[model samples]
Target: MSENIIQIEHLNKSFGDVKAVSDLSIRVKEGELYAFLGVNGAGKSTTISIICGQLSKDSGKVIVSGRNIDDGMQDVTRALGVVFQNSALDMALNVRENLETRAALYGIKGEAFRKRLEELAEILDFKDILSRTVGKLSGGQRRRIDIARALLHKPRILILDEPTTGLDPQTRRLLWDVTEKLRRSEKMTVFLTTHYMEEAADADYVVILDSGKISAEGTPLELKNKYTGDFITLYGVTKQELDKIGLPMETVRDGVRIAVPNTAAATELIVRYPELFKDYEITKGKMDDVFLAVTGKKLVGGNEK
Candidate 1:
């Protein structure tokens, strides 16, 4: 197998007059956990659908597991597995039944299928709930079932679109650990789209999409070093007092206080007027700061485009 498990070239797609994705090209190396960071409707889902052969691209070449998705749909799709934000499972079936049915659909049955199910059950901690109906399971459990279903076919590349969207912090963290284990143990190439910046932090590589284009692509540390310099957060009793700082500052509403970048000039401003900014605190640059610097807009707004 090639080092690059998935490769996209000059991908373009449109719906009527609106272009969802445009001239976007990227590559996901083997065993890489690539995070696609963008808000809702930033074309992240559209791109994933195109690559998975769920949706047709207006123009572009999508290569998955060395097969062109458009040219060899069957061959390309056979090597790819996709899990959407919403669970795609038969709620009436038990966890094991769901996986068994999926495997059967892919022409896998008998002893080999049973063995694969056993392995997945042990690895994903689904042993206890194997006989329990999926509809009766908790949200986290259902998500685990969804993941297990995706792995039943044992594809080389896996794509998850916001796999942990509504999961709790602990559950989300657990999913991250599971994904790491899959990559390390199975050498599965994982590609995920997430709005959570913290999730992006843990990825091997991050691609920030905005307006159907990639704004930044690098490791989390690399992005922080390239964009964020410092942080200037102001702790004040009131918003009026923050406004009265009488200097340019990026106002961020974190419940009560406001925050701004503590750049070199901001340091000079503090040095010149120490009394005015006595209540302010300076900290290292944050991922939020890096996002703001790159987008020129507050990260609070969920609109990535």
Candidate 2:
């Protein structure tokens, strides 16, 4: 079994009269992509800030790679590579210059710096944009550079906070590809926070937060099975036929949707009436449904509470 790389126990944080995080606990295993999901103001950012040492927790134990954060932060910082929600690159500086500055902070100079930059450029596929000004590059291009800067020190864990928020679909796919490649090659554990349900659906494990506390935690399929139902939509089938079949169904725009207890039930219906289900689509429960079932709010779009 993989060991836990990051662990938080009974974590709590408050601001004035409001509690930002409440008795939260989570474990992230090595080389796994763990998604921390929550709507805005649900304490996602606050928890991340505390984990990154930007904000101190009220009371809790935070251990990163076997070192207690309270004992010393330098080791913790060295073990983590963070890419914040907002871009942190200098607009006026070219990619090479920006990367050079960040590399110098880690004392990687001369031959070592050049080699590291080359490796990242190849890994992130940003060699062509190294001379381009950050402000002039596209959103996707700048994001790649942001990741490169964070990875310059080759940290064991990579924390991505809303890394694909406003990018186009193609860019998002490209970013995920790079992330997966890094995970396999560098053996790094990924800690991700994103509003996109589809993105969270791909995580090895997901933890949903609500009102500053853990609402749900499991693999995507596990959550779906626990909180949602499977749907089978049949086209070119009359409502009377569905009624005669003695199954519960609802009328949709192009067809009728039947709610089944599981995939086996859906398949049984289809096998029993192959002709009736000639034109059909079977869809399992989605992450959005799981989110809605657990939290009262939607996953995307809204001002943070």
Candidate 3:
């Protein structure tokens, strides 16, 4: 039987009157990458913190690698690696030195540490700037070093919080490519929480949290297929021009809105009318559309309290 590397059951946390995590349960199987998708303040970070022992849970229990997190905090933490949303690297230290210090903190030193460093550098393809100060590294390089530092301890499970946030499109794609390669090479279980729809779409399984609860759980395609109908994005010359078409559509920002029944309907419209709108796009279902359909909220984080 495959073991679950991380498990949380009926977890809850509160701050005065606010319930951060309520009745949350999640289990990540060994060697699988699980992505948590949610907006800000949806308890995704809070739940991860509890599992990592950074924050105490108000109720329920969390187990990491066969040991309860609260009862066996030391062993549980030792078996886990974390890459937070914010970079935790020391700007003053050189890249190698920063990793060396972190490796020592994990009780790894001497020849063992050196070998581990070499292994990580080779695996991560980070050879050119080992001696450079972290402050001088680009955002993507720093993020990679942070991930490498987490690996020095040789943890069984890795948790990344919004690993691609605040990066440009090219950088984001590069990071995702690196992450995919790492997953293939390391074969370690990974738990990632992010707001990026594309990133969530790439995960083997996604846990969608809404209003401090599990709103959806499935593979990316599964969630999209289950929740999303056909959608059409229409862009008209003017608002009145779009209104004149009179197709049922959901309004998006600026001059974009999605109409339903998707490709078939879109093709029918184009074939029959040919003059409804000057420009439009069509697709079966997307992560953003699924988010809207399931939560009744936009993926841009607006309309969310």
Question: Which prediction has the highest TM-score against the true structure?
Answer: 2
Q: What is the per-residue lDDT of model 2 for residues 39-109, given as tens digits with 9 covering 90 to 100?
A: 88888889889988999999999999888899988889888989999998899999999999989987899
Which digits, one per residue and each the tens of the lDDT, describe model 3 over residues 80-148? Answer: 889998888899999989999999988999999999989888866778889999999988788878889
Clashing pairs in 1: 232-262
The backbone clash count of each candidate, in order, is 1, 0, 0
Candidates ranked by TM-score: 2, 3, 1
Which stretch of 10 consecutive residues in model 1 shows the poorest summed lDDT?
254-263
Better of 2 and 3 by TM-score: 2
Q: Model 3, which residues run further than 4 Å from truth?
A: 231-283, 301-305
- Candidate 1, residues 1-305: lDDT per residue as tens digits? 53889889999999999889989999999998898987677789999989877889999888988888767688877787888889989999888888888899888899989998888788778899999999999999988888888888888888989898778777677777877888888899899898777777878888888778888888887887678755576655455655666645565675233334435756786776576575666665666666677766554434643
TM-score of each: 0.81, 0.93, 0.81
Q: Look at candidate 2 and tell me the lDDT of residue 181.
A: 85
